[model samples]
Target: MKPKNIGIQMTDKALLFINGVPPENLPDTINYSLIACSDGAFHYLKEKGFPLEKLDFISGDFDSHSGKDETIYHEKFIFTPDQNKTDFEKSLEIIKERGYKEVDVYGGSGGEMDHFLGNLTVAFIFKDDLKITFFDDHSHYFFAPNILVLNDVKNKLISLYPFPKAENITTKGLKWSLIKENLEITNRIGTRNFAQENSVTIEFDTGNLVVFIGN
Candidate 1:
């Protein structure tokens, strides 16, 4: 059976930049969904008047949720008291169980250091089964091994971070080419790279490479 194209939006304990309302193009409809990770995120969504009814379900321990917001969306919320996993991980597990091949995460990186790092690490935990992308107000970050083709990323900032030690890496259409360069995580080898054209290609011979692109 083919995997479902599930879009997972997470509301971590983060500060959102509500710049006069988010664009309508922001995804309001999700085929399978999870919510109530953080009370702050829930409040922001409510303030923006996002469609809460479209969510498949909301799962979270009520530690972060105040009684006020709980009353607002009680019918559609699933209160889970599990303290073992983070809300972000819980949401990913739910999506994976539903057989989603790709998961897009928003509002994951703006909160406390532990939450931000926890959310980022969640990508690796589910990398084999799902393509997870973390998005913030300014950047989109994901890890890809083997070959990655980025189209029309001109004038954008792209950085690569190698994990578990770097291996032979090469780049095409980038300002700097790796050409079998070994980039260790301790060394800031893959930072501040630019795209020379509308498209860019990167290939990693070994190890996981995290690619971050933003303004």
Candidate 2:
């Protein structure tokens, strides 16, 4: 069966709980599936009044999820004792197995550096199969390799970070145009470029690039 498009909400073990990062207009009645990495996140959602029934499944080592509330949500849990993969990765695999083509991850930032980087790596691992976005209240980040088309959205800041190798990149409708410029990882040429027109187009010949669009 084709997996239904649902709101896959992930809760990290630690987050600063920033306000206004996740837009207030986020749909309330989501076809939601919650992935709770830590017991604190589970309790956080419970406190926020997100329904228990909406939580399709939860996976993590019990280390982060040991608490009284853990029992409350134990019926829908998958405990993987393997330390090889992070909880975020395990949850992503579940989404992929169910054939989800898109996922928006919350509570992914403001955690330990290792976990944050791990979540970022998930984007690269599944970039071809799915549109994975890491969204905090402040920003949304994703990777682009080929041509990237940006729609009309005002007052948003866009940045590009080239991976290890040099990349030949070009941009249209932006303040600066690369025009076949070689962008190195150490170079800041791709940083802080804005949209001059309604739409912005970017093309990269080589290397992975991360596009961060923020307010």
Mind giving the per-residue lDDT tens digits that candidate 1 earns over 1-215?
Answer: 32124454433222111112233334533333332233335556666677655445566665666677678777756565678876667667766776566766666775466666676677788889778776666778888868999998987888988764568888898888789888887875698988887899988777888899984
Best-performing candidate as measured by TM-score = 1
Q: Pairs clashing in candidate 1?
A: none
- TM-score for predicted model 2 compared with the true structure: 0.77
Best-fitting candidate, scored by lDDT: 1
Candidate 2 at residue 54, lDDT? 54
Clashes of each: 0, 3
Q: What is the Cα-based lDDT of residue 8 in candidate 2?
A: 51
Clashing pairs in 2: 21-137, 21-138, 22-137
Runs of candidate 1 exceeding 4 Å displacement: 1-40, 64-72
lDDT of 1: 0.65
